[model samples]
Target: MIDKNRVFRVLQLAGLVGLLAACGPSFAAESDAAGDEIEVVPVRGGVYMLVGGGVNATLQIGDDGVLLVDTMQEDMAEHLLAAVRKLSDKPIRYVLNTSGNPDQVGGNPVIAAAGSTINAGNVAGAIADSTVGAAVVAHENVLTRMSVQDPPPPFEGWPTSTYFFTPTKDVFFNGEAIQLIYQPDAVTNGDSFVYFRRSDVISAGSIFDFTRYPFIDVDNGGTFAGTLESLNNLIDLTVPEDKQEGGTMVIPARGRLCDESEVVEYRDMLTIIGNYIREMIDEGRSLEQVLEARPTLAYDPRYGADSGSWTTDMFVETVYREFTANGSSEQ
Candidate 1:
């Protein structure tokens, strides 16, 4: 069961947590108001959601140590660490990057540096010093993208462990079975869905933003088809307790906590919009015509934005481009 009181207290300390409106290829800048402090919300089975710093991060705590999924922005590292300290004094043994976006993995250097990794010693009973911090993990594509950035990331921020060509990577950490399920060509080629099996929680990266329209990075292998497929996969992994409510909590890259039903609602919305866009493309409608059609008109009031880094217009245009490009609409 969730600790409602704890969540309420965290919310009080964190103030009004605003929904993330624009998370493009490079996440749009957020005001210092929400970024200045970190709010920790307990999920279940030792899992917690650290809400703030431009992105929501997941933490798994146990006697062994702590496992973190998606460290927020670089500027928020100090506050993030302070928030983590409030939860557990143990070192952060593992850091998982859901995507290569700055908001998702920006705090890699500082957060990792504060952690200590345990290593075996050459001698029979000696334990090696653990000043090396936590082992950062991500998909191989993440490392590739971050490596070639205009101003490369610090060495410490780079993912120390990466997996490629594999559908999933599994790690048993902090008394839970953690699975890093790669989401190919969705939000980005490096996107991952971190599932904590025992805890029944999933750390959905940029693929599922509860706040606004999904940002599909066309340049980085993100596609509308892939996004829909990843959402389907997430739904499959989620199981509801009763009446499609509760059970299998989902922590998105940004926004409040969610469950299987919310994922279904999001999936259905995307599917409906995709179908509308596809029908327009088949009708030989130009991008302008489709934009005028207002396929996402209904959802705009909730998930759409007229002005921001990523607006409803941008979302429609991207989908239109993806569908018409090389006749991908047939797919």
Candidate 2:
């Protein structure tokens, strides 16, 4: 008595609907304005989130000088610098890069040049090099990748300080302990999460994007599993004030500031999608069948994109390829 044919047709139509939704115009990209206006939002403890210029940059200002994280793009350096000047007249002591993406480090040359580095007094009682500028710190992999680009970044933009083979690098500035935790193969192999201990804030680079689906640059050694691991690491570093409501604040690569709870939700979403795709792969489904299955259907309404630099289809494919390439759906 069951209408088997009707049920099959209904399922097929549902898959088509999911596909259509995934391919809809990219609302995620349009919503984020990478324009001239840079909004300076204060987080706790002399820390601020500079929003605009395609990505967010974090600044910790005090009497000692400023420690800035991420420098937006090259063109927006002036706007970003103007915003910094408004907050503090002190020199920028350090520029911490989360990744090597152009949007994340493009303004390095200009921004770093605008500040002076702290140097010990020489025998002559003068500074060693007055124009040394602020120290740009990042994972050595960032310098390696950026240096080999078609048109390499400006010499001034290259990181002056790099860490590798170590899980984290730490420095004390502006009365706070800042730690740069290396997150391999997340957004890129060189991604870092900068934690301001005194401020109780973390500047999570591309590892966490509150707006759109995480962009895993497979060509650049980024892996879906690694991204999930980094998100887990983020959760580990955070502590909630009460009932998981507030405590440690997070400034994502883009979008609004968040706390522990929001991060858990994002992590859960990725985990669920990963499980769905992995199950389909274990069923011996081909890539085409997998796409048609719409593993990301539930999250499409929130993080899906049809036509952006990254899309839902792209994410699904990345996960699928990552799993199948291993010849086993282990992860």
Local distance difference test values of all predictions, in order = 0.82, 0.84
lDDT of 2 by residue, 151-249 (tens): 898999899899998989998887788999999889799999999998899999998998778999988889999999999999999999986777999
Which residue pairs come into collision in candidate 1? Answer: 115-133
Q: Determine which window of 10 residues in candidate 2 has minimal summed lDDT.
A: 23-32
The per-candidate count of clashes, in order, stands at 1, 1
lDDT of 1 by residue, 1-331 (tens): 8656435533442231222123221223332338478877889979999888557999999977888998889888888889899989987888999999888888999888988665652123324358687888999999999998888999898998899978898888766788999998997889999999998999999999987889988888898889999999999999999876789999988777888877887887788778878877888889998898777766775678989788999999998888888584586
Report model 1's TM-score to 2 decimal places. Answer: 0.87
> What TM-score does model 2 achieve against the real structure?
0.88
